[model samples]
Target: MKKISLYHTEIENKDGISGHVRSLTDDAFNQLTSSPLKSVPGTNPEQLLGAALATCLNATLEAEEKRRNLPHQAIVRVAVDMGRDYQGFQFWLRVQVKLPQVDQQEAQEILAICEQRCPVAKLLAKSQNVKIELVNEFGFKEEFK
Candidate 1:
């Protein structure tokens, strides 16, 4: 099979978790980054990771919904927790998906399919720290391990 590049971009961060992050491919894509432990006005890696997964997974679900002739009403919520483990600091991501227009069984089916199709979800699929769930309603709160 031939490899084709559909989209590509680069991001740079010089200050680790306390300064700025900018995209090399897009001039308008610049933002401040800070540690979640601090009360600073910036975004952290955890939030960014959550945003990526939620956005990508929901976009995949949108495509599937379109294909099924349904309205785009899928919601994705990702909660990222950072903690210390045996190997030092580790991250856990809890991804919850809600398809309000469908039944529980069908929503679960769509979530399973989307998990295999979403690029970000697929990238994190093998990690034992990541979990994807189909939810009837979002609580938006979770106890981290």
Candidate 2:
């Protein structure tokens, strides 16, 4: 097997409420809560997760189509619902994929392969816990232990 690539991002907060996320490419995004009443301006973690899953799934689907030489393109939308369960936090995702040039059966087959091929989807299927690092501006870092 070929070597895999590692993607990294750093989320830094001076206070506990708001912060910024910086990717390895130096792309910076402001991070904050999505509550309308408390309305802080920025993208929340849930939104980022949804975007990642949706993009990865769509890319996988396109790759599958290319392997099969099936001239098709898809519009993929993922809705991620985050709530609290008995174990604390739980996430539910609804993936809606629309393949315009293909029939329902072909679409189903593509979706099945995409689900298996998408790394994020496969990881989420097993309910794995991700390790997160909380770093303060004072250079103190804490990892989830």
Candidate 3:
């Protein structure tokens, strides 16, 4: 498939402790800094990564749901853990997706498709460990890795 879109962002960092990020969209400006425990108030790369993955995966799932005529409300929470690994720095993700309009089997199916379709999920899962939990209205839950 040919690429249809390209997104750009720039991060200005000096001391590795504080920085600013700018993307093509004017509303995408963000103040970047180390974790609160390590520095002053601001956002860190891990937080931004988690946020981006959550939003991107949610959008992908929304599109799939629309295409499949499966209307549902959902909340996706993504947690990113950053630490040192044998190869150097590494990160992992814990994602929980709550769906109000599907059963466990259906939710799992939808999430499986989303995992294959979401670009962020694809990229991250290639190099980072990603764990996803899907929950439905009946309280049924399933996990994927």
Candidate 4:
């Protein structure tokens, strides 16, 4: 088997990590995020979770669209709600994925893929490594990528 690597690029300005995202295929991408730390300008972890789910759903949808030759673009809109818990802030995401000409059974199947394959959804569900790192208004912070 051949090892494949996909490349994507982003730049940070006054507003955190925001730039173009690309892959082996697809020309669908826009401004990535805004630092929620107010000082940092990029989105926080919770927003990242939502973005992760959306990314995975979009990726999966792209593959399916190509396979089925569907007309019009299939969109996967994901919304993540945040709240406090015993551990920390917990995110409740509602993935209202919309696609054309898909039945309930098919919708369920796509959702299953998003739920299982979306890295953030799986990570949140698995509860393997859940932690929060606090930083100052504009202080340096680091973690495992």
Output the number of the lDDT-best candidate. Answer: 1
Ranking of all candidate structures by their lDDT, best first: 1, 3, 2, 4
Tens digit of per-residue lDDT, candidate 4, span 118-145: 5555666655333222111222222221
For model 3, residues 1-145, the per-residue Cα lDDT tens digits are 9976686555555646565554445565657576634757778888888998889999988997888898847678887777677887777778889867887888888889998999888887766487778854223233322
Where model 1 places Cα greater than 4 Å from the true spot, the runs are none
Angstrom error at residue 59, model 1: 0.3
Candidate numbers, best TM-score first, in rank order = 1, 3, 2, 4
Per-residue lDDT for 1-145 in model 2, tens only? 9977797566565544355554444556545544322567866667788788778877887898888897647667765566668988766665567776776777777777777788987877665442211111112122221
Candidate 1 scores a C-alpha RMSD against the true structure in Å of 1.4
Per-model TM against the reference:
0.94, 0.67, 0.76, 0.51
Number of the predicted model whose TM-score against the real structure is largest: 1
Could you tell me how far off, in angstroms, the CA of residue 124 lies in candidate 2 after the best superposition?
Answer: 1.0
lDDT of each residue in 28-91, candidate 1, tens digit only: 8899999999998999999999999999999999999998999999999998999999988999
Instruction: For each of the candidates, give the backbone clash count.
Output: 0, 0, 0, 7
lDDT of 1 at 92: 92
**In candidate 2, which residue ranges exceed 4 Å CA deviation?**
1-3, 6-17, 28-37, 128-145
For candidate 3, the TM-score is: 0.76
lDDT of each: 0.92, 0.64, 0.75, 0.54
